[model samples]
Target: MGGGIQWQQNPALCNIMQEPWEEPDIPDVEAPTPRRALTCLSDEDSQKIYDSVPRTEDVFNLHRGDLELHEKLGAGNFGSVMKGVFRRGGQLIPVAVKTLKQDELPNAESELMKEARLMANLQHRNIVRMIGVCRSDMIMLVLELAPLGPLNKYLKRACGRELTMNKVIEIMFQVAEGMAYLESKNFVHRDLAARNVLLVNEQFAKISDFGMSKALGLGNEYYKAESAGKWPLKWYAPECIYYFKFDSKSDVWSYGVTLWEATSYGAKPYRGLKGCQILELIENNRRLERPDQCPPGVFDIMLRCWRHDKNDRPSFRDIVELLRKFRSKS
Candidate 1:
C-alpha cells in the first residue's frame, strides 16, 4: 500500500508492490550410468583352474629326504627360488625349485602353467628344461639347475670395473645363436631381458623362463592386447611403447639393449629417465648408446636396433650372420 500510494517502485530493485513470485521450475537431469562390473570367478572356474595345473604325485614329498634344499638361487613376486639336490648314482644332482605364492593373480598361475608346458616340449641345448612341477594347493617347479645364475650378475662380480671385448662378443654371439633357433621354431621370447637369460655354467648361456613367451599362431589376435602389455621398461622397444605390437622385431630391440647392458659390465640402462621421459627421448630421436667396452661393430648393431620404425630393425637371423662374420674377422 505504501509503494502504490506514495512511492514509485524501481524495476531493478525488489518490487514491494508485487506478490511473492513462485520459483521458476527446471526439468531434472539424471546422472550418467556407470560401466558394467567385472564378473567374479565361480567355484567351477576355480575348480577348472585347479584341474589344469601340473601335478607330481609320482615324486616324493618335499618333506621327505628324496630332494634336499641347498640354497636360494633367486626370489620373485611369487616365492623364493632355491637350488635342490636329488640323489642319482650315489651323487647329488642339482635342480632349481620355484615355490608359488597363493596370493598371486590367476593369470600368473596360468602363465606358470604355460611355462611348464613349453619347457616340457622344448629340448634344446640353449633352453632351460623343466625337471618336474607340483600342482598341490601350493605350486612348485623343479627345473634343470642353472648353477651360474644370470649371466649379467655373474659378469658384474667378475668384471668389477670393466668388460673385455672378447667376453662381450662371446656372450652377444651366443645370445644371437639361441635367438635364431627360437625364431626358427616360431617362438618369440616376449620377455628377453638380461634376467631371463641364464647361465648353465659360467660359459653356457641358456634362455630360461618361458612365462612370457609366444608360440606362432594367427587365431589368437583377440588376446594379444591383454597378453602383450606386461614388459620390462628398460628393455622394451619403440614399437612396444608406441603400438603394443611386439614380434621378433621387438626381441631385436631387447637384444640391442641386452648388448648395451653386457657391454656396460652391468651398468643400468637409462637410469635417470622415467618411462615418459624415455618415450619422449625416443620420439625425439634419442636412444641409449653402447657402454665403453662395446666394440664398434656391436655398437653399429645397437644403432640399427634403435631405428624408430620397427620394420627397419634387423632380424635375429641377420644378427647371427653379422655376429658370425664379426667373430670370424676378429
Candidate 2:
C-alpha cells in the first residue's frame, strides 16, 4: 500500500540509557506482550522459531498457485509491492504482496522475514493486517489491501473534493492511535511518515511498512547506522538525525511532520530544502509553520511533538487524548 523506500540497514545496538519516563518515582510498567501465533512446539523449537521466522498457525501458508498477481503497486529497496488476490476456501480475497528482491543481500531477505514475523504479532484495526506468508525461492508477505493506497497520494488527489480539517485530524488521529498501540508494546516505528500510512476504502487509515520498525529494549533506544541507510531526515527528530537515537518520543517528532503533511494537503515537508539544509534549519531551532488551514489546537500538538528535547515531547497517549479533544470540538 506504500512505497519509495531507500537504502536499508540492520539496527545497531548502543549503550544503555534510561528513558525519562522510566523514572525512580514511578515503577516501570511492563511492556505488553505481542499476541503469539498459535503453534505447538517444544521449548527448543520455540526458541529457534523466535530466532528465525516463526510459523503463524492462524495465518495461512499461502501457496504460489493460490495467489493471482496483478498490477504492480510500488517498489522499494528490498523489493516491490504488488496487488494480488488470494484464493482461499473457494473465496477470492484481495491482498497486497510485498516481495523480497532476490538480488538483495541474504541479510535483507532475513530481515524482511523477521518483519513478517513482527507483523504477525501486530493485529490492530489501524494497522495493516498480515494475512500470510509465501516462503519459496522468493519470499513474499501477504497483507490486507488498502484500497486507497498511501495517505500522501490520497491527500494530493483529494483536491477534487475538499480535504476538510476534520478529515485530516481523523487521519492523523488514526496514525497516532496505531502508534500509541505500538508504543505500549515497546515497538518504535522508526520510519513513521505520511507515505507509510495507507487508507482502506479512502476512510480508514492504517499504518504500514514495518521493515524499519524496531522493538525497543535496553541499549537499543539509539540505533547506530551500520551502513549508510537512508532515513527520513525531514521527519526525524533532532536526536535521531544528530545521534542516530530513536524511541517512541522520536516517533512523536516524525508524527508532527506527518501532521504538517496532512495540514498542507500532502505537500512535502521542508519543501525545496536538501536533507543537510533541513538539518541545519532544525539545528537552528526553525520549525515548520502552521498550515493556513490548520487549527491552532492541532498546530499546538505539532509543536509539542517537535520539541528539541525528546523528553519534552508528548507521549503518543497524550497526543491521542489531545486529538480526541479536537475531534470532539469539531
Candidate 3:
C-alpha cells in the first residue's frame, strides 16, 4: 500500500491578496480572427482579473529567460501545454508550461490568472503543484510535471493489463482525499473527472485543470453561476444542471463518474447519449449501470453519490472514510 507516504502540505505557498485590484492597460496583439464566435473579455475586464492576483513572490516568480521549451504535451481550445525545463537556482527542473494561444489571449488571460491564484494557495501532494508564473510574451504557468499524463488516457492505454484491483482502488482513494481537501477549503472544482485527474505515476494521481474552479464566498453553501457555459452534463448533479447551483455535492457526483471511468478502464460516460437525452434519463431516475469489473461495494458508493437529492449524497470526507475501509479489506 502507498499509505505509508504522509500527505505533504506547504503553508508558505499560500499567499494570495484579498484586496481589490485595479485593471491595467494592455496593448493589442495582432492575431487571426477566430472562425467561430467566441465570447472574449475587454482589456479592462481582463486586466481587472489579472491585477486582482498579486504578483508572485520572487521565489515563485520564474525568469522567462531561464525556461527552455521542449515537446508539446497537449493542446486544448484556449491554449496548449508543453513539457519544458526551467533552470532555477542553477538546477534544471522538469516542468509543464501552459501558454495561451495568441488568438485566445483576449479571452483566456483572466481564466489563466484565476487558475494561478487558486493553485498558489492550494498546497497538497494530490493537487498539481504550482511551481511559478511567467509573464513575458504571454502568461505562462509553471507546474510540476506529471509524466504519465491524464488518468483517463493512462487507464485507457494500460487497459487494466498492469493495474491490479487494489491499485485501482488506491487511485480512487487518492482522488477522494484530494477532493476532500478542496471541500475543506470551500473551493468548488467545477470540473472533476478522470480526464482532469493527472497521473504522476502508477500509484500517484493529482487533480488538475482548475480553470473552471470557483472559490465559494464566506458562509455560502453553494455558488450560483450567472451564465450557463459549457459544462460536463454527464458528471453533474441534478441541482447543477437545473439551477446552475454547484457545491461539494455536485463534485461528489462527478467523483462517482470518475470512479466509474477508473473501474471500467476509462470508458466514456453515456457513450451514445446526448445532453438532452441524459437529462431525460435523469428525470426518469435512471443512472449509469455498473461497470463490468466494479465490485458491489464500490458500485453501492456510486449509487449513493447519484442520489436524486444532493443532501442525501455522501460528502467527500465520508467517501474517503468509506474507501479507506474498503481498501483495508481489499
Per-model TM against the reference: 0.74, 0.80, 0.81
Query: Ranking under lDDT, best-scoring first?
Result: 3, 2, 1
lDDT of 3 at 46: 25
Q: How many residue pairs clash in each candidate?
A: 0, 0, 0
lDDT (CA) for every model shown? 0.62, 0.73, 0.75
Model 3 lDDT tens row, 155-178: 777778867667888989999999
Instruction: Candidate 1: give the clashing pairs.
Output: none
What tens-digit string does per-residue lDDT give for candidate 2 at 1-330? Answer: 010111112222111111111111211343222123312333344233223333367445778888888888777656999988877666566688999887766687778877887888886678887777887778899887776677777677674274577877887898999999998888988888888898764446889999887677765655554543555567877676555678899999999999998888887776666655565566577899998888898999999998888889999999999899887453
Q: Give the worst 10-residue stretch by lDDT in candidate 3.
A: 12-21
Global local distance difference test of model 2: 0.73
**Candidate 2 clashing pairs?**
none
Better-scoring candidate (lDDT), 1 or 2:
2
In model 3, residue pairs whose N, Cα or C atoms come closer than 3 Å (at least 3 residues apart or on different chains), thus clashing, are none
- Sort the predicted structures by TM-score, highest score first: 3, 2, 1
Please list the residue runs of candidate 1 whose C-alpha ends up more than 4 Å from where it truly belongs after superposition.
Answer: 1-66, 87-91, 160-163, 218-223, 227-230, 328-330
> Candidate 3: lDDT over CA atoms?
0.75
lDDT of 1 by residue, 241-312 (tens): 444566777888888888787777766677755555566677678888757766788789888877877779
